[model samples]
Target: MKSLFLFFFLAVSAAIYAQSASTAIKPKPSYCNEPPEAYDSRKNASAVKPAALPKFNSKPVMEYRVQVAILRKTDPTKYPFHRSLVARYQPCEEVWIVESKQSFRNRQDAEKLRAELAKMGYGGAYITTLVGYE
Candidate 1:
């Protein structure tokens, strides 16, 4: 009798679960419903003109700096010009460039530093212009 009651209880539970599942609302998957005019690029191309390139201020600004050395490797601690000294790596040239930390407004100031550096071991030191930090 218990076994029959157990079977009937399972049958009723399954029917109730099935009826609830069928009545439950299911969400439908959304799709891109774009119009045919938007999909047609060629027809839209005539309506949309190409954007013009932005204009930049072409005025050139010049600054001078005394270049101490250009080497594959450099030790900042060993550099003689400890005051206001900076080193930058040139990836294209594959070299480490050592220069003055600050730019001199006048070429004469840069030349003076180059002359002093030449007196030291850095004989190849020269005055170089940094064109827009190039």
Candidate 2:
């Protein structure tokens, strides 16, 4: 009976040791499953062709004149008041206006208007040129 008990105890201890060993030595998955095409190097290397350049047509480029407002208003409330004053100078009330002209056209017209407005000594009145549209 003593030998039998000893044999049963050894068997149970061996089984418990195996269970703990298996838990400690867990299997991990492999990280190399992705194919080469999934990488940037392979994708870029496969497309070695250069992109096509765009073509342009020759035509008389239409230009536009723009009147820019260059004055900075220190007081926000004065914006409406300044606008009203500018409207007095421009009968059309176009505190802003655009005119279409040729690309090589002289900017004298726009500059003269800006100079005249500057002479009036408005705090927020100035002009600039811009590309015109049809």
Q: Each candidate: how many clashes?
A: 0, 5
Q: What TM-score would candidate 1 get against the native? A: 0.49
Clashing pairs in 2: 63-132, 64-131, 64-132, 66-130, 68-128
Candidate 2 overall Cα lDDT vs. reference? Answer: 0.44
How well is each residue in 1-134 modelled by candidate 1, as lDDT tens digits?
A: 99999999999999999977864433322332343444335554776666665767675568899887776644444555546567886654556688888788788988888787677666887788866532
Model 2: runs farther than 4 Å from truth? 1-46, 58-78, 81-104, 122-134
C-alpha RMSD (angstroms) for model 1:
23.2
Q: How many angstroms is residue 19 displaced in model 2 relative to the true structure, after the best TM-score fit?
A: 72
Output the lDDT of residue 42, model 1: 54
Most accurate candidate by lDDT = 1
TM-score of each: 0.49, 0.28
- Candidate lDDT values, in order: 0.70, 0.44
